[model samples]
Target: MENTIFSLIPPFLAIIMVVLTRRVLLSLGVGIVSASLLLANFSLTGTVSIIYDAVKGIFVSEGSLNTSNIYILLFLIILGIITSFITISGGSRAFGEWAITRVKSRVGAQIVTIFLGIIIFIDDYFNALAVGQISRPITDRQKVSRAKLAYLIDSTSAPICVVSPVSSWGASIIALIGTILATHNITEYSAFSAFIQIVPMNLYVWATLAMVFIVALRNIEIGPMKIHERRAVKEGLVSDPNKPAVDKLQEDLPTSKKGSVGDLVWPIIALIVGVVGTMFWTGIVGSEGNVSLLAVFENTDVNTSLIIGGLLGLAVTIGFFIRQVLVYKSVDKSVFKKGVWAGTKSMLPAVYILLFAWTIADLIGRLETGKYLAGVVEIINLNHSFLPLILFVIACVMAFSTGTSWGSFGILLPIAGDIAAATDISLLLPALAAVLAGAVFGDHCSPISDTTILSATGAGCNLIDHVMTQLPYAVISALIACFGFLVIGFTGSTTLALLTIVVLLILFVIITSRRTKEV
Candidate 1:
């Protein structure tokens, strides 16, 4: 009992700090440090040697910097630089101006922005920053609250990316599925094949997107978000005093020739075309007698797909800069440098968040407790005839604590899959869905989650504010998902369960909105 309690103390203390103080970095640091100290307690050595071994073990045997993780960070950095360049070149401003002209009302602007976010579908990081920057001015002009704008951008980012087949997210999911198949000794399942099979079962991603549309179109209100929306409507446009005065300088300049919409549209198109064409050329697409895309993805030492995508985005952004310069006939080298510098600066926070999350995740992996945790989960027979709602809750908690959906899936799936093998339950779909949904739930809500932080930063809301405001909505949806999973677990009809949840959520939102108005 003492050992068990001691083993659990670090994660518990971390949560307490996060909730009480809302300092994500501090919480993560404390958890990692405490875990390291606990690990040192087991080793018989001098203080320095014990500390050295703990830190070394973290990045070596446990969570060493692998090619895959390196690639993810590389993609993030390159994408950040490209996004920064686009913003500096006046592309975002041009897009904002064009969007404002088309959107006559606040609701229309919000809906259109969400639609645009759906269409991007290249990468979540790209989608978040580009959409937020392009739509911020337009939404502000329409008297829409920054909180609402942030919510829309955040909602659309991960959900859309997870579902789309041609994205960085898609690539990651494919890799994970491949690992699953290999571990199961299944030779017939390919990444693309598995992806197609799992797509329909990804209820959480689809459900979240559906909710965003319902809220935007029907003007639904719930929790803190509803309060923020009401305040925005009643107070009109409350100018952010914290915004730098340099922002005002852009107001007086004549709109660029490409326009804000043009700025946003062209670069996105280039990125899509480049990624698709490159993937096809490299045999990622099914072609006759050619190497399989999966083979290429696996064999390549670098994350070639993301590298290719980033390079393409960069080229298109450069073209936009040239076009602006030539059209205005007042371009200089300094202008280009300024754009690049601005883009890089905007991405700094995202870079910091990613690095910290990566380090913390690595630290967690080092603890022998992680393996013990996995063993405990397996021993519980959680996959066998368990209550779906309880399983959902457990999955969420595990994913949240670990800060990784893929890792959580790896741990849970085999155990869950074994249960499926033994019972009447069709383990493939439900188990996979549970893993995906739980990971997304944790990813969406956890303050230390890189994706969550990016969403907040991209939306330009205070980090804590975004986390606090978004929590209620995420929880409501998760509860709905939990109940839906229960229904599916009993009936084994996921489609029916999903449809039922959608309809009920829609009705609930409508009733809630009406009640708030009456009050």
Candidate 2:
């Protein structure tokens, strides 16, 4: 019943198993069962009881299946519905067509790809698949390598989502941070506060995003990316065999209406406005009209606001879909129901995955894994200045191995928060930021990451080629992030750290460029 070194085994073992088998669900199940066994003191009956208790805890427990988490789940469901509506209505195809006509050059094509990648800030999987599928044709016509496009899609997908405040990634991050804080009985802080504060410290995400634009705007390439670009331009070979051609995920039904760009644009804008507005509205309402906007944000429930936004977006999408159907008469009325049902069905699996993640994370807490890991940190007694970089590296390694940033977050954040609180509370945001940034960095380059695979699939390139070509660029951004974290860890000045990273990246790009290819 006491916290011990063994408490850490389940998380680490799960990570190892994930790395070896590339099986997230199995790995997570194994972790939960293993922890349950240990908590049962290795008794089979006791372990079963533990599992039962955990299941009960998720739904019946007071806080585990509470309002906040429920809303978060609802938000995801609505998000899926919106995405399905977009695809089945032919909104995606219409937008892609509209976008390509304005692209007068290769740079313009790549820029549009990057722009689309950045703005798609919903889910990483969606971002990758959408950007890659939509932009690939334009890139191919412009002679840009599928590898480059994959890199663009892969890099932008996670990086943008992880930073976007209204995204699924943001919800996951908030939920994780909040759960950890609650477990620690740290009521003085808010997850939203931490989420907002940590943004500046998330150097890897910023660096990765910046690197994509740098690559796009500067017309340069490095390492294998350079060679791939050369091959594409000179040989007119766009696809790379190293990349696996993953079949496009089928929509509920083909669209007959041929949706306009406005169809895609309007829903997303409504979603964004809804999310932002509801956040403030909830914040103000929670504070009883006696707090600043920041205070309200730090006090309001993000899960509720996000759910509201998602629902609002869904309503807007439904309205638009009906209007289009009335005007164009393109698709049958039955198509709408099928699209909604399909979207809802697609998200159920993901929602279940999140629940499983929550269960395992709870198991870790029950096992006192955080205290065990924090004890080890205390034993090392490393300088607080080194903690950010150390935590960043650890997070990156965990995420890279598991190919699941969410898992890495669930495992590391509570422990990191524990270590920081027990050592110096000031390091809390930095530690969280480090873990978030590192997890994203690892997920970006990980061969097994869903986003990475989807990027390759969407671009119709070999998966391995995307991985290999993107590696150098990912490493460069990571290295820069590492240095920036180190500086910020020591000085506590994000401005200086960001400035240093900017200079370093500019120099690297300028020094590394041989001759810019037309592609």
Candidate 3:
């Protein structure tokens, strides 16, 4: 089954089960077991060994600690603690009350969340969690559903990073492009220049961003998202009460009446500073003294930076927590232990989901799923003009199946370059751009995607609910982007493609608005 059509079964099974059952962990477990069985040829003992090795690999790879995964998990735990402390200190409550006076409308709240997500484009992980902590209070106060907030965060994080030259995503993609360019002996453009050129050609990023803004500004709601939004507005039920949320706090925690917005604002600011500072330090140290901007980004240790920053944020939050109990005397000192336990417990759901997700993703890699998809792309004898569109679709399937955009990029970008170079070197950048766009599009829609998981965690939304609610919007954006890629493929005119996106989005928003009002 490895590296063949059978390699596709595990992911499809996981996706189908999750959609039908809305049970994330159970579905992932089934996928994991099925994948292990396939790899082991249905031998129970061999399957056990494969599963054990895959699980072990998540924490221990190449006889060393998998610091990337460990650090990200640690960051989530620390972030959950900080969120709990913020609430217990009354920072969330105070901030929401404060913002209600200023924001005044649900649309204003959602727009603020959208803009914050766009502005924090350094890394998707940081963007998703940090933006949620900052914007959740205001959005909740305005009765905006957690699902919508998760959608906003997920939509902006990847799309912005994919396009921005300064982001981690850009650095990774540029490095890949550099290798691809070198392999093809294409000397007309540098990787940095190619990345810039490819930016406009990434029509999905544009289409997604357009839809994000239009949805915020026009109050457009579609599919499951509409149901969520309607419930939030009419009943003030921002989340499904029966569902478990990664960011859900314990009930009846003691809150300090004296807590101010500064308690919340300062900790988050410290977090950002600490994270960006650590990124620079790690980048410079790794660069061996040649610390150019792109070089810094390329060499930066993202997971390590996240944990260091998370620690700083946690420290500040603890300080505020102590102040609430010790100084203000509004919160009981006895609540300290419960607060800590509550915070840790809140994040366990997300952690368990991530662990399973990582395990299955690793097992899927062992199945050579991406390699099979890339092979399919390479063997297709399509027209040169259709290369971008074809690569986009293949990348979507590959990333969706593997549940990782970077994995798709690692496997597909080089193949795309090879195909485009042999057929039409001029289409190389567009083709690569299409891969980037499609990978993100797939990541957005995949329930098993880490970014998708973290987005729901950060927003305090149900995981499956976030996946289902955001699917319709992601599909619409992808369809528009598909058309854009087709236009760019044949006409090689980004302006024309962008114009089409704008016109289509306008029609979509108008149509959605009328339908929403009628409902």
Per-prediction TM-score to the true structure, in the order listed: 0.79, 0.68, 0.98
Candidate number achieving the greatest TM-score relative to the actual structure: 3
Which residue runs does candidate 2 get wrong by more than 4 Å? 1-5, 63-65, 103-202, 215-252, 381-388, 391-476, 485-500, 503-519
lDDT of 2: 0.74
CA shift at 447, candidate 2, in angstroms? 10
lDDT over C-alpha atoms for residue 478 of model 1: 83
Residue pairs with colliding backbones in model 3 are none
Give the per-residue lDDT digits (tens) of candidate 2, residues 1-519. 536877767777776675566555687789889989989999999999988888677666664456765775676677767777776677766775776677767788898898998887755755665566467657877789888998888888888878766666776678778887787777776877778878888999888888888888886687778788988888888765443243322344666556887777677777767766776677678675568644454455656766777777788878778876787787778787788777777566445555665677667778865445435544666789888898888778656644567777777888888888888777788888998898898778765455665577557666567777898889999999999989988998889889989999888776756444332
For candidate 2, list the clashing residue pairs, or say none. 242-462, 243-461, 243-462, 243-463, 244-462, 244-463
Q: Put down candidate 3 lDDT per residue, 321-372, tens digits, no spaces.
A: 8898888888887887888888888899999999999999999999999999
Residue 267 lDDT (model 1): 73
Clashes of each: 6, 6, 0
lDDT head-to-head 1 vs 3, winner:
3
Highest lDDT against the true fold, candidate: 3
On residues 100-210, what C-alpha lDDT tens digit does candidate 1 reach at each position?
Answer: 788888789888779878987766655775676567767877877666776788778877776666665666667776676676666666867877776666666776777
- Candidate 3, residue 241: how far the Cα is off, in Å: 0.9
What is the Å distance of residue 294 in model 1 from its true position? 6.9
